[model samples]
Target: MLNADTTDPAVLRELIAGELAAARERTGRLTDCVEDDELVAQHSPLMSPLVWDLAHIGNQEELWLLRNVGGRDPMHPEIDPLYDAFEHPRSERPSLPLLPPKEARGYAHDVRGRVLDLLAASPLEGSPLLDAGFAFGMIVQHEQQHDETMLITHQLRKGPAALTAPAPPDHADRLPAEVLVPAGPFTMGTDTEPWALDNERPAHRVELPAYWLDTAPVSNAAYQVFIADGGYDDPRWWTERGWAHRQQAGLAAPLFWSLDGGQWMRRRFGTLEPVPPREPVLHVSWYEADAYARWAGRRLPTEAEWEKAARHDPATGRSRRFPWGDESPTPAHANLGQQHLQPAPVGSYPAGQSPYGVRQLIGDVWEWTSSDFHGYPGFRVWPYKEYSEVFFGPEYKVLRGGSFAVAPVACRGTFRNWDYPVRRQIFSGFRTARDAGEEA
Candidate 1:
């Protein structure tokens, strides 16, 4: 299916079921790579144990698909408190009575079986949940998100390599320094998108002055220039808060990067290798991305500007669902779905470029924007308030596009991800922008 259009109920059901299976398979692959001990291990204080996530995925599936959709009684109702996210913090999850790996896998598998049977028989005409298979989409997106978080935990775990993939090829090129997004009004969010979350609701218009955005994400080689020139040391390039954080944290370079014997090396999934200069830099904090932009005499694009760059087509005056257009992403279009362990070299996916010739706008790295996370003009709490309502504030900064770790269903043009500005453990990078008429 090209999109979540409700024109054909049978096609919609098939599409949702296929994507749901794919998401479950990805979660299985990630969990299977590590030992059972690793599944129970707490890799980081900020994340729950892998086992918690495993059962949490199953719990959420049972809640949404089984009880809610199929009108079935809860299969494991007593364990609800153990998996309630808001009821427990990440650091405390290891203490909870989480299901063992074997039990967790069986529970999730059982839930999937019932959910699939329901999908095969359920009517899809009424209620928002069944409208174009929105609930199934939500579950798939949720599971895939946890899969990405699990991948992060793998990165943090201390062990021999548990995951492997071929390296992304060097495809960087001397493209335009910046692509011009003309001054005008363009549709911002989506009202018609069947599965759009609350934060991206009620598609509206945003007027932006002309600006120039980097044709591709900032690369490791480019970031190295910042480090060599003392970008971290210079207070002028950093905001007062950022400088203070830098001083307190003693940050010298992007997380996982170090200069050894005059060559830059990085630890990736328990393996150290020379930094791939052409690849988009990953695991940098929003503060780091912001400081890099300042050092280079540019600024991080606003969330609106980033969206316009990715989705707006001036010729048609419409917003597409992706940088490459309304078509769903394919391997040829992006390095998504954890198919590759690392980002493709900047400018690798020419086919994925936006209409404005901006490349790598869909995947490779989650691109940080200058905007704070907030609700749209006419936003309303939907499905659940915790999904987005609790996050509408300046406490978090928004990241756009998606990373190689993100799944296609969860990485659409309107999808939004947010984190604290100091977070660097995530798969993130940035591209700088400037006012169209500003001096270079």
Candidate 2:
């Protein structure tokens, strides 16, 4: 199917089923990589036990697809509270009465089998949930999202490497210093994207002044210059709150980074090596990104500016669904789906460049934006308000573009992910931006 064809029910069904299977396969791979003990253990206070997420994925699928969309009675309704994320924070999840790894796998597989049956038999229309198979898409995306979380856990765990992938493709050609995104109005969000989450809704036109954005994500080499220049010690570059947090949190460098003698070394999924100078810096909190931009005499782009850089196609006078084009991502276009397990070097993926010749906007690293998380104009609750509504505030900073750890199923130009400014556990990075007229 070209896209989620709500008009053609059969095509939608096929699309839903395929994505469901793909997500499940990835989930299974991620969970099965570790032992039952590891699955039950919470690798970090910020993340749930892998087994909890495994069962929760199934629980959500049963709740949304089986019960809400198909009108089927719940299979394990009694255990719903255990997997309810809102009911318990990540720090306490490992202590909960979660199913063991085997049981979790069985429960998820059973739910998947039943969901498939429902998908085969149910009508794909008549309600908002069923229309265009939104519920199925949501479930698929949710599972894939949890899979990304589990991957993060893998990164945090102290052990032998649990996953492996070939390195991201490299580009020898040098990238431009920055790209000019001419000032213009562009639709900033999506009204028609089948699986776009609530925050990215109500397609609104936003007029923005011309800006210059880094052609690629900030590389480790560049970030090191900031660090070597005493960027961490200089309070002038940071916001007051950021400076306070930097002292309180004792953040001297990006997470997982250490200065070994004179060389900067980093741990990646249990492997340690000298930081790759050419690769985009990873695991940087939004605060650090903002500070780096300020130190460099620029600023992080606002959410709208980031979107315009990623989605707006000047020649067509329309926003494409991705940086490269409307078509879904592939290995050739971007480093995504944990295929490389790390960001590709800067200047890689010329094929994925935006119309203005900006590179790697859709993947490699989730780029931090200056905007806070908020609902678009005309945003409304769908399925549940807790997913997007509760988190809309200045407390959270918005990050655009999926990271290498992010699944393509859960990412789009219109897709929005947010977290606290101090979070660096996530595979996050940023590219600096400046007003078009700013001095370089």
Candidate 3:
């Protein structure tokens, strides 16, 4: 995590150098196979042109971190007019005069070299320049995000790469739904130990009555039961808003699923295969999850309740960095990093369960909560204004944990993410919760 102490020039140099190397390695692999023309094509709404994405990422380093903190000019001054993502919306991206792929690659390399040199010359001790560590971290994270986008885009435009490997199947069996969570007061939110997002601020107390959360996210097999029971056709299962959205879109099942031979098959990337019944159902919208919960006689937990169960310790204000503990994410702990590039069986990560034994709470797929997206008691906006404020309306719903594609750095227990209720293209699923009085 980038913090005040991380601003030390030595630390900054080493960190930035390592990140620069990683960025180059990933981008180099992309440019090797993807042609310049292909780099600029709009593969999908979720992805950006490779050329524009690469240039914008490099330019951001100069504009936000380097120029803002170090007082340096952008590598190509002309790029600021065209490639600023904050200034240019996705719809307007294709019209921009994006740099040629070769030129953009050279520019990125040059910017890294210049920034590294500046870092080397700067004082290591007590330098105010460290204030830019957030910006630098953001840049590194941005590049990593692009790396995933490149992977998805490549799969979309071409096919699954020869080198890419599917995520190993998780063979764990689902625990019964009768698992009980004891009634207790659990302190929720970040305790100000270190860097935390604004939404996780003003560490608060919450009391959760004894209740039951599903031992795992709803599996495809369970959802298939809903499908077989004609759950989608029943307006009773859906909220008024959900029913309207379903009718408008003609949604019959999870976005990636289709019926063939009276059996379910799911589209993974561009390839269609039999639905893995044991796997956690991915690409389900909050609306869909809500409907499933309604049909299953349950509801999504509030954000406070979810955090209370996952991170908070009522006695000491101690919370796990992830669901399991303070240790960072590992491949065995969660299905992230495109390791399988798909959802795994819900109970695969019993070791990563929360203190109350709620399983798969960290990753595999982001779990939806009933909470609306809003600022906490004393929420203050970070440098990026649009990050939270833009999605405060009902358009977005709260989601926890990380998904298969979410970066490790961005997947902390306290990190909050949101998406539209109707959008289900990403890796998302849900676990059901019931009122304390309700039977499991």
Candidate 4:
């Protein structure tokens, strides 16, 4: 809640610093799970080397915090060109001069030290970047995002499991099919959130008719039905582009799933096991989710509808920062921050339920929505153009609700994540929606 309560500058600074430190700690933990060689290895052509992301996180922090926010000199000017994401695609990162794991760790550590010092002396007002501690929050969010990317690299890497987490609490209760979001106009996006990125800015009212959203994300058991019904083979359920991509990729099941001895199994991190029927299905592309919705006689919720379900509080005509309430996420609330390598049971985390009784709307997996990644009405790029402006197009689909691999600081009810429809490496899933009058 970096900007949720920004009236007290001291408190805001402390929260910002704490969030930054926590994000750094998580990055270090994820990187430490593997050796230096693994860090340098490009796990997938689609993702940068782990070492590249490690340094790039530090590079971004230095450029934004030390250079822009504090008006300090660049720490390593030579490395700037190499780490620029747009300049070097993931496929070319390994061929570039990336700092070794040890050096990258030192650089990130040093950047954090300086950033903390700047935060201590920096006034928390003046420009928008400092007015609400936006820069610090942005840096924290950027690092957390990269940490999530690194986790994806780990997922794509062919190695023994290098990460570990205890299983989430067991919950056996069955969830209802859908929850009705009382229709009308509900506030969407945020004008007051200090650290909200450009795409999520300028709070606006979105009007929608009454609709029904799934109580929780589609579970593995539910997705299994789609596979059984030849959801992939049937062209009727897919969009033109989606059907084309499906045919080209020859996708039969989710990315890491396979059938062994007539039992559906999935590769989780480093081990293969029977797919957990109760868990939210992970690593599904937007196309697959869309087709599944069609097969189930439902549709992916529009971004507005999804946000309305997660943020709108019908009783008070207000939007909560998270599904549960205005308070920040707690351990009991959501399965996030890579605390668990995989999603918890779909019905778990009852405390995180929305006002409409929508469960797991904020965690589990990055739930897909039907909307494209377009700028909000009155959206304007602030601070930087590339952070969001570059990705504003129909080619990318929006995904809401942070996944288990997502960090709390990087997630909010308004936070937006988008990717190509064919991307299944990131933790993604979907829950279906339909008009309120529709029969189930």
- For residues 199-297, could you state the per-residue lDDT of candidate 2 as single tens digits? 788898999999999999999999999999999999999999999999999999999999889999999999999999999999999999999999999
TM-score of candidate 3 on Cα atoms, chains taken together: 0.88
Compare candidates 2 and 3 on TM-score and give the better one. Answer: 2
After superposition, the stretches of candidate 2 with alpha carbons farther than 4 Å from their true spots are: 1-6
Better of 1 and 4 by lDDT: 1
- Which segments of candidate 3 are over 4 A away from where they belong? 1-20, 23-33, 119-132, 149-163, 169-174, 191-195, 314-317
Model 1 CA lDDT for position 193: 79
Task: Output the worst ten-in-a-row residue range by lDDT, candidate 2.
Answer: 1-10
Between candidates 3 and 4, name the one with more favorable TM-score: 4
List of clashing residue pairs for candidate 3? 167-340
Colliding residue pairs in candidate 2:
none
| Model 1: pairs clashing at backbone N, Cα or C within 3 Å | none
Candidate 1 ranges beyond 4 A from true positions: 1-6, 169-171
Better of 1 and 3 by TM-score: 1
lDDT of 3 by residue, 13-96 (tens): 686667656665776676566567788887776667878878877787777656876787655687687876668776678778
Instruction: List per-prediction Cα lDDT, in the order shown.
Output: 0.90, 0.90, 0.73, 0.90
RMSD to native, candidate 4:
1.2
